[model samples]
Target: MAHIVVLSGAGISAESGLPTFRDVGGLWKQYSVHDLASPGGWERNPQLVLEFYNTRRQQAREAQPNAAHTALAALESQHRVTIITQNIDDLHERAGSSNVVHLHGEIMKARSSVDESYLVEMNDQDIALGDLCPQGKQMRPHVVWFGEMVPMLESAADIVATADVLLVVGTSLQVYPAAGLVDCARPNCPITVIDPGEDVKVKGATIIRKTACAGVPEWIASLKL
Candidate 1:
C-alpha cells in the first residue's frame, strides 16, 4: 500500500473552532506565551500554566474533527496514512486515522515535571496547582513547551523519509524542527500543499491554495477515494 504522510498544524484545527495561538479570540491572547507555553512560565506561575492547558484541553475535547480530518482518515482504507502533526490535539485519531505521530506531546495527558517518562492520562477536567504525579512531583501538561526538545522529531523525519506521498496541510513551514521535517521527503515523493495562505510553499509541490477543509477533500476526490 502507498504511504501518505501528512504534516499538519494549528490552522487545520482552527476550522473546528479551536483557535490558533495567534488568532484574535483564542486562549493565547489572554496570556503571554512565556506564561503559558514555556518552562519558565511554569516556573514563575505553575497555577497559570496548569489553567491555560486545562482550558486548551477542554477546547480540544469539545472540538469535533473537521472534513480535512475525516478525509485523511478515509485514506486508510486503501493505503497507509502516517500523520505527523505539530498540534497537540487528537483530532486525526478521533477521525479514525490509525497512525499518528504527535511531534508535540498530547494535551490530554500529564507528566512529571522532573521526569519525562512518568506520563499518564489526566483523569480530571482540570489539573489543580497541587496535582502530583505518582512520583510526587508536580504534574504538568504533556504538551511540549518552548525551549524543550521535540522528542518525536527523528521518528517523524523517518516517517517522512518513507512517504510515497506527502501532504503539507495548514502549516506555513515557519516553525523549526517540525517545519524542517519536510526536507526529509524522498526526492521522487509526490508533494502537495493544502492551505489558503500565500506564504505556504514547498518547492515543486502541487499547491491547492485552499483551506484544508476544501483542499483535502478535493485531493481525495481526485484520488477517487
Candidate 2:
C-alpha cells in the first residue's frame, strides 16, 4: 500500500466550527497572541492561561470532525495514512484515523509543571487553577506554547520523507518547523495542498485551491490510490 502523509492545520478544523487564533482578533476577544499563547503569559497569570485553554477545550469538545477529516480517515482503508497535525484537538482520532502525530501537543491532556515527563490524560472536564498532577505539582495544559520546542518535529520529518503521497490542508505554511515538513519530502514525491485562500505559496506543490470540505474528497478521488 502507498504511504500517505497528511499535514493539517487550523484551517481544516475551522470547517468544524472551531475558531482559529488569527480569526479571533477584535474587541470582543481582545487577547493578543503573546498574552495567551506564550510561556511568559502562563508565568504572568496561570489562572488566565488555564481559563483560555479551558474555553478552547470546551469548544473542541463540541466540534465534530468535518468531511476532510473523514476523507483522510477513510484513506487508511486503501493506504497507510499518517497524520501530522498542528492542531491540538482530537478530530482526526475521533474521525477514526488510526495514526496521528500531534506536533503541538493535545488540549485534552495535562502535564506536571515541574516534571514535563509526568503527562496525564485529562477527561472532558475543564482544567482549573488549582489542578495538580500526581506529583502534587501544578498541572498545565500539554500544548506546546510559543517559544517551546516541538519535540515531534523529527518524527514528522521522517514520516514526510517516506510519504508516497503528501497532502497539506488548511495551513498557510507560515509556522516554522511544522511548516518546513514539506521540504523533507523526496523530490519526486507528489504533493497536493488544499486551501481556498490565494496567498499560499509552496514551491513544487500542486495547489488544490479549494476549502478542505470541498477539495479533499475530490482530490482523494483523483489520487485513485
- Top candidate on lDDT is 2
> TM-score for each prediction?
0.95, 0.96
Candidate 2's TM-score reads 0.96
Model 2 CA lDDT for position 143: 92
Local distance difference test values of all predictions, in order: 0.88, 0.90
Tens-place lDDT per residue, model 2, 1-225, is: 999999999999999999886674444277766778898988988887788888888889999999999999998998999999999999999999999999999998888888888887877787777888887878999999999999999999999999999999999999997989999999999899999899888888899999999999999999966
Task: Please list the residue runs of candidate 2 whose C-alpha ends up more than 4 Å from where it truly belongs after superposition.
Answer: 25-28
- Cα-lDDT of candidate 1: 0.88
Candidate 1: Cα lDDT at 80 = 88
* Candidate 1 per-residue lDDT over residues 1-225, each given as its tens digit: 888899999989999998786552455577778878899998899987887788888888899999999999998998889999998888999999899999999988888998999888864567887888787889888988989999999999999999989999989999998999989999998899998989877898999989999999999788632
Winning candidate number (TM-score): 2
> How many pairs of residues collide in each model?
0, 0
